[model samples]
Structures are given as C-alpha cells and as structure tokens.
Target: VGHLAVQIARARGAYVVATVSPGKLDFLRELGADEVIDYTKGDFTDKVRDIDLVLDPMGGDHAQRSLKVLRRGGVLVSLLDVGDNTRTQAGARDIRVERMSVVPDREGLVELARLIDANKLAVHVAKSFPLDQAGAAHAFLATKPIGKVVLSL
Candidate 1:
C-alpha cells in the first residue's frame, strides 16, 4: 500500500515524503519519493513539518505522531486505528482526521489501470508461492518484504 501510494501521489504531482527502513531508502527514491526518511535511524516527525497530508498505515501511536507534522487545515488519513485522543488533538489543531478502508470501485480501478498503462505506476511483487504454499507465503510476509508476497492459484 505504501509503495502504491507513493507512486500515485507522485504521479498526481505531489512532493511525496516517504518513511521506510534504511534498506528501503533507495527503493522509495526510485518510486519518486521526493524525500525519504530512514525511520529506523530517528524520528520522522523531527524531520518533517507543515505537511498537507499524511497517509498512515501504521496507526495507534504512529497516527498520534503524524499529527505533529501536519499544518493547520492539513489532513491525516489513517488506514488503521485512529484513537479518540488523536482526533481531539487534530480538532484542536484544526486538522482533519480521516479513517479509510479499501473499497474497490470501477472508477478507482480504471484510474489505477490508466496509471499502470502510462508507466506511472509500478507494482512490485517480491515473490509468489503456489496456493498450497500459503503457509510459506505468510512466513515470507513475516520477514517484512520490500515489495509484495503473493499466493498463486
């Protein structure tokens, strides 16, 4: 999701800032992230500020931390939990907090397809395992792959 988001945001002309493990710094850069933070090295909030939007996949405390970087009227879109305290803090700062769930629609799919066709979007499949190797797929995912791990039928 993060990889796709980075590409989509860049394709839309956003100056994207992506945070990743040290090993993935170059990976995000290649995906068109204007700024890439090695999150394992230090706090990303310390380096980023006054942002228009933050797409947070790791919620909870991470969502709370993201609020610090958003400017007034900025938005925080979380894919996971957004605690009440985070919402209250955001409201106080005049920041909008949104929780999003993936609901695929034709319009969205078509847009994504268009992006892919234009070579503006790249899908990285780290590895694929046969359907019978579902357990192996899960284990590979647990290793924190750089891209996606798939289970093929």
Candidate 2:
C-alpha cells in the first residue's frame, strides 16, 4: 500500500518522502521516492516537517507524533487504529484526521486498473499461497513483508 501511495503521489507531482527501516531505503528510492529517511536511526517526526499528508500504518507512537510534521492544514490518516488522544490533537491542530476502512469502491478500482494498464502502477506479489493453506498465509504475513502476499485460489 505504501509503495502504491508513493507511486500515486509522485505521479501527481508530489515530492514523496518515505520513512523506512534501513534495509528498505534503497528499494524505496528505486521506486522514485524523492527522499528516504532511516526510521531506525531517529524519530521521523523530528526529522520530517511541513508535510502535506501522512499515511500511517503503525498508529500508536507514529499517529501521535506525526501531527508535529504537518504544515497547519496537513492531514494524517491512520489505517489501523484511532484513539481519542489522537482525535483531540487533530482538533487542536485544526487538521483533519481520518481513520480509513478500505472497502470496495467501483470508481477507485476502475482508476487503479487504468493506472495498472497505463504502466503507471505495479503490484508486487512478494509471495503466493494456496487457498487451502489459509493458516500458512497468516503465518507468512507474520513475517511482515513490505509487499503483498497473495492467495492464489
């Protein structure tokens, strides 16, 4: 999802900055990230500032500190969880906070397909698992791959 977001943001002419672990720094740059920050070395919020949008997956600490980086009207989206503490800050900062629950949207799917066909987007299936071994798929997911682990049913 982060990879897709990076591509989409860059395609729309946004300067994409990714905060990644050390191992992913080069890979993210190869995918056209304008700047890559090694998140393990220092706090990303301390390093990044005046940002427009943040797509946060690890919502606990990241969702809390990320407000500091926003340039007044910037928004932070939490994909996993949203706590009341985070909500209060968003109101205080006067910036929008969205808790996104990804559901099927026909228009979005059509646009994604168009982007894929136009070679503006690529989906990386890191590993494939059979439908019967759903438990194995879940185990593989425990490894925390940056790319998709697809189920080939």
Candidate 3:
C-alpha cells in the first residue's frame, strides 16, 4: 500500500523517498523513486531528517521514529494505530493516524483509471499462480517481490 502511494507521488512529480524491502531496489527505481532505502541495512533515522510528510502503515516503533523525522508543522498520516498518547500531545500537528480500510470512490477511481490510461502509472504484477498454490504465493511474498501477487482464478 505504501509502495502504491510512492508510485502515485512520483507520478505527480514529487520527490519520493521510499522504504522498500531488500531485493525490491530495482522495482522501486522502475517506479521512479528518487531514493530507495532498505530499512534492514541501517536505521532510517540516520538518513532522513526534517521530512515534510511521513506515511506509516506498519506502526509501533516505526510510527514513533517517524515523529522524530517529521519537520515542525509537517504532517504524518498513519494507516495503523493512532500511536502513543504522548505523540499527539507533542508538537506533531496534523498527525492523522487512523485505520483506512476502503476502496476509492467512483470519482477517485476515474482519476486513477485516467492515470493508468495515460501511462503515468504502472502496476507491476509479480506473478499469478494457481489457487492450490497459496502456500507458494506466501513463500514468494516472503521473498519480497515488488508490486502484487495474485492468485489465478
């Protein structure tokens, strides 16, 4: 989900600093990420600072660290738990942490379709396997393939 957001941001000509899993470096580049950071190699804190926006989906400690990197008056939107109470109490204004679970509306979908039709966006389908091979799909996902994994109907 975060990866998709990065792609959309890049399509809009924004500089995207994407945090991708290992082995997805080439894929991130293909999606036009300005900088791709492998979180396993080093702490993101050492590299990013005073960021204007931080999008967090995997919460817990990541959300806490994101607050540190966010510049004052910046916004942090998390798709997980609303973080600790202290985070909101602090100076992290415009911090919106809520569980987002829904598809886009018709208007939003229309725009998305237009973007795809214009070649401004690319959706990478890693592979399609049989439904019986669900375990295989999970295994392949554990290897961190960029984009999506779909089960053949």
* Top model number, lDDT: 1
The list of candidate 3 runs beyond 4 A from truth reads: 89-99
> What local lDDT does model 1 show for residue 145?
90
lDDT for predicted candidate 2 compared with the true structure: 0.85
Clashing residue pairs in candidate 3, if any? none
Q: Estimate each model's TM-score.
A: 0.98, 0.91, 0.84
Please state the error at residue 2 of candidate 2 in Å: 1.2
Candidate 3 C-alpha lDDT tens digits along 34-148? 8899989998888988777888887777777777777776776777775566266434465444545657799988878888998877677888889999999999998877678
Clashes of each: 0, 0, 0
lDDT of 1: 0.95
RMSD in angstroms between candidate 1 and the native structure over all alpha carbons: 0.7
Off by more than 4 A, model 2: none
lDDT of 1 by residue, 100-131 (tens): 88899999999999999999998999999999
For model 3, what is the error of residue 144's alpha carbon versus the real structure, in angstroms, after optimal superposition? Answer: 2.2
Q: On lDDT, who's better, 1 or 2?
A: 1
Worst 10 residues of 2 by lDDT: 117-126
**Whole-model Cα lDDT of every candidate shown, in order:** 0.95, 0.85, 0.76
Q: For model 2, state the Cα shift of residue 43 in Å.
A: 0.5
